[model samples]
Target: MKNYQLKRLSDQPILQTSDVKPSIDGFDVLGAFNPGACIVNNEVILLLRVAEAPGARPGFVKVPLLEEQNGVPTLIIKEFPEPEEDFDPRVVTIEGKAYLTSLSHLRLARSKDGIHFTVDEKPFLFPARMDESYGIEDARITFLDGKYWITYTAVSEHGPGVGLAVTTDFLDVERIGMILPPPNKDVALFPEKINGKYVLFHRPMVSDIGRPSIWLAESIDGEHWGNNRYLFGGRGANNPRFAWEGGKIGGGPEPMLTDEGWLLCYHGADETHAYSLALALLDKTDPTSILDRSDLPLLSPELPWEREGFFPNVVFSNGWVRWPEGSDKAGQIWVYYGAADDGVGLAELVQS
Candidate 1:
């Protein structure tokens, strides 16, 4: 049965690489996608992952690096010999260390009707500290404790980890530092503490040894996390038997609280390596307990836009908003997701 109505589809990308200029430096914004969704002042707020790559040079491939010199913002251009290293447009691997083909920063975008978005021309956050030298990507926003909390993937030479930041107005951001260590991504927190403890979902990966699986954890004060429980992922050496999601899976946007249970929309890749959206129901009282899961994906790459660009056949979302009760569009969910890892798209799911 069809559940989602790609009803208000944006023919082109709502947010794309060409939408915004490069960060303070001369780096070009290669991709502006994977926005974490939230509603503030009756407007849709998206924390967008903005990836910037260096300008083209014939023999040298450049990677933008953010640094600080005497309290002044600086951009360090890291150049590599084009032929010596494996140079992909998205990744430059050198001496076994895989570095991003571009540096990423988070920018803000806003919308009133939840369809048309107005992205901020200027960058809101950039990589400067050593821990985030590689920059940040894929933020999951949660409103808790009187403020909006952001859990994003922090990349660096050390590895990819999860970091926390809080902002009440989306203007002044207070970073709480890394919450989950390296080899981890896809982190999101429930809006409220369950049974007096904060709950978080994360996908942790081990290099060449462990499988990438979603893990559930609890925190007392939202700072330190513990009591981890494996959630779900592909099994049996990359073929878990689940065809549409046999390759791998990761937690999507913040789970929505419903009368029936906690509704989770996650992304999974099958043997064909196509990324699609899957749904599941988790126990409200004990979120770790799975109640129901869809046998097949609810949304897959169907449109030409969804099947083309940075990562073809991919539809990934980190943000969403429930329609306001007073609005005419109540009882619906607006999912803002990245299409093919290059631009943003939206879909609305009517509640059952």
Candidate 2:
């Protein structure tokens, strides 16, 4: 558990400074949300999840900011005068009343140094009619063959699913539609095509067959995916109290392929929903085969900002960047994650 170390790069409130604010007519100018980062055109570009309030009752409909009216952003909030009798906590409900929450949309920001960022005036990607009725969340970007393939979470009343989008110039994005169906999320596509096919890691939730665990899938084309197989399962330590991760583990940023294997950074959560980061090595040829894995966490909730917020004790990542080799401080991966479902956080991972 102590072998791995997680250095804080950018802690909570990564976008909370006075300079950063939700667009006047945007959805999530104030709320802290998740983000995806990539090195593009010598600058770090971030696609952030913008969550906003719907002005409805606390338990009622949640809205998404897609358009502006009179220079003010508008939210499409669902109005439910009457709710159902039985409701599920995880699905979306506070009390007897049933209402929707604001869906996730994409906002654009750029940085020269990967630390300081300036947000774009207008949203880069808005919710489209295809499969994003509930909005998008946690985009994982992979640059391959001159195209940027983005895998993100598409949420709706049915369930949280995975969707695909592509961009060539970062400004124009073409929606590829939903690749993974409902009850699935936390998907990351490999940087390159594996055996002439695209490989991706995903998690499919099954309350009956097995616990929510990581799964692997491959596709000839990046859009259509198949050959789903179980990648990893939950691990319970003998001493329950000492186990930081027990419930589930999911693939985080794009896996870094090395001569030894594919270095994977993933997130694990305990029963209490406390999340931490872990590292694993998979066979370069067959990513489904595990080579090695860290028994302990590489990063965990330690700081006050990380330990407290909307959903406390969580550090979840969607993207990372590795420093180039041949330098004094090479072989380092910068992980950009969401903190407590509020703001974004960063961690530095040096080769061990």
Q: Highest TM-score: which candidate?
A: 1
lDDT of candidate 2 over 95-139, digit per residue (tens): 533234555577787887677888875667766643566667888
Which lDDT values do the candidates have, in the order given?
0.82, 0.73
Per-residue alpha-carbon lDDT of model 1 for 1-352, expressed as tens digits?
2443334356666777677777666667778889999999888899899887878889877777656678764768878777563456777776677777788889998888877778887777777566788888999999999999999998888888998999999999988999999989999999878999999999998667766788899999998999999987654354455677777789999989988788888888876779888777889999989888876777788888889888788888788889888887876788888988888888877643
The C-alpha TM-scores of every prediction are 0.93, 0.86
TM-score of the candidate numbered 1? Answer: 0.93
List runs of model 1 lying over 4 Å from the truth: 1-8, 67-74, 84-86, 235-241
- For model 2, the stretches where C-alpha displacement exceeds 4 angstroms are 1-4, 10-12, 17-20, 23-30, 56-75, 80-99, 237-242, 325-330
How many clashes does each candidate structure show, in the order listed? 1, 5
Model 1: lDDT of residue 247:
74
Q: Candidate 1's C-alpha lDDT?
A: 0.82
Q: Model 2: which ten-residue window has the lowest total lDDT?
A: 89-98
Q: Between which residue pairs do clashes occur in model 1?
A: 37-319
